[model samples]
Target: MEKNKKVVILNILLVGTIILNLFIFTSRMRFFPWFIEDAWGYLGVFLTAPILIGIYFMLRHFHKQQLVTSTNKVIPLFVAATSLIIVFMPTTDFLNIVAIVINAASVFLAANFLFNQNGGKNNYGFSRLKNQS
Candidate 1:
């Protein structure tokens, strides 16, 4: 797939994973007892492992294409680490807030990456300038 397409897919998957995590968190807290069960919350948490792996491969593909910078590469790792913390750590108010902040940061980073893909160039108007003789 094309680079932009791949990035778009990555964003979608990231959002989906975040939503899944939210569902799991809320369900465990009995926020949506009718919609989601505690058992399903466990299942959702387990499902995130593979989704995180997929995100890593997608980022690796971008790295191979030179579309992603070395510094930007660390975002996904941070995201995965935070995600693991969410899974393994006891669910507390502080941890929930932290997870929300991290997820928001990741979304922002993805947006920044998409916009700066062309190095912030605004290519407009005529392509060539005429020289004065």
Candidate 2:
């Protein structure tokens, strides 16, 4: 129960952070308070979701085990959904760019897991699988 609670809190915090970052990014642009160099590096803020979602799916659903398609697919689907959520909107702020990049990474991962569950090649790095194969 404690672990579950922790996971829930962590997930909430992660999401909150992303949203807050986006809000801050937008606010910063209004007054031009941020340095040009700072804003320049913030283009890929949306990718955070995809990356985290992918890892979360792999851990929660895969058990780090390789399985044939038509087996359990719930986690992969969850991952895709999360990926979509993380990748909500694009922002020009550095922080937003980082978040977007993470989100996009998650999308790739979720898609990979989804495909793998459907008997497709595993592109989302299942590091353990390599040793087995």
Candidate 3:
């Protein structure tokens, strides 16, 4: 597949996994406290394994230094979603800690990629930060 397409797909997967993690975390906290236990937390880790793999692939693309103008548009959304999760999540357990780390890492990466020093008009560095008319 094309490189840009691959980046887009990876971004989608990353965002989807973050959303799922947030949903599971919130539901467990607010409504189904008993049903969501350590096992479920482990299950979330397992479910999020793809994100690790996706990051690996994304890193490969990043090494190539290809501009991901369209894919960059997803960064702010990812940052916002994960930030909300971090703000609302109760960090009282190991699983919560793991989730916090994941969200933080996602935010850091998106922010770094969005504002890389190499960013320029042509290279927008994979992020699409432009004003629409």
Query: Each candidate: what lDDT?
Result: 0.64, 0.42, 0.52
TM-score of each: 0.66, 0.30, 0.46
Candidate with top TM-score is 1
Residues 1-133 of candidate 2: C-alpha lDDT, one tens digit per residue: 4543433443454444344344434433545454334444233334544544553564454343433222222433443354344445453356445544554453454445443343433556455335674
Q: Over 4 Å off in model 3, which ranges?
A: 31-41, 65-91, 94-98, 101-133
Off by over 4 Å in 1: 26-42, 124-133
Among the numbered candidates, top lDDT falls to 1
Using alpha carbons, what is the TM-score of model 1?
0.66
**Minimal lDDT window, size 10, model 1:** 124-133
RMSD of each: 5.0, 13.0, 8.6
Look at candidate 3 and tell me the lDDT of residue 59.
49
Q: State the lDDT of candidate 1 residue by residue for 32-112, as single tens digits.
A: 564554335545666775676678777777878887666455666666677676768766767766776776767677667
